[model samples]
Target: MIIDILAALFIVAGSFFMLVASLGVFRMPDLLTRMHATTKSGVLGAGLIMCGVMLFFVDSGVTLKALAVMAFTTLTSPIAAHAIGRAGYFIGVPLWDKTVKDELHGRYDEETHVLRSPEHMQDKQDQP
Candidate 1:
């Protein structure tokens, strides 16, 4: 009885967070922002849902599978988001207006695919 109650709570929470993540994808202005929302909340929601399912299932095999899937989701979601964001950036997708700052500005060299911060840039400039 208690397990069922706990599982229900987690499932509801997971569903709510997943819903929020979906809404964020639609509402956020930029790809990076949307990626952040989807990756963070999406992983969290999926993790919670997996936890609920694991709790609901007492069988060891089922629990192990759920855990494995949760682990995979946790590991992959952020990396996937990062790859997507970086690809978007390198492809020249415009950032949203009112962006406070671009730390990558003047730092990245497209040809070499290198990122150098101010100190590195200064050092290179002084070398010649």
Candidate 2:
């Protein structure tokens, strides 16, 4: 009885987070913010849903598969989101007008398409 209740709660919470993620994608002003919402909330929702599934099943095979899937999602989602965001930025996707700051402003080289750290830029300036 307790297990069922716990599973139900997790499932409901997961569904709610998934809904939030969907809303974020539609409502966020820019690509980066949308990606952030989808990655973080989506991963959490998936993890929680898997947890509920694992609990409800109470079987070793289902539990193992659920854990494996959860692990994969946790590892890949953030990296994928970052790569997409970086690609968008490289291709000149504009940030929202109200953005507070752009940390990558002068750090990225257009010609080489490489991002240099502040220390590296400083060292180059010192060399010349």
| Candidate 1 Cα errors over 4 Å, as ranges | 117-119
* lDDT per residue as tens, model 2, 1-128: 99999999999999999999999999999999999999999999999999999989999999999999999999999999999999998899999999999999989999998899999989999995
| Candidates' RMSD to native | 1.4, 1.0
lDDT tens digits by residue: candidate 1, 1-128: 99999988889899988998999999999999999999989999998998899889888998999899889999999999999998898889989997899777778899999877799898989995
Candidate 2's error at 55, in angstroms? 1.0
Q: What is the Å distance of residue 59 in model 2 from its true position?
A: 0.3
Residues forming the 10-long window of minimal summed lDDT in candidate 2: 105-114
Top candidate on TM-score is 2
Candidate 2 regions exceeding 4 Å error are none
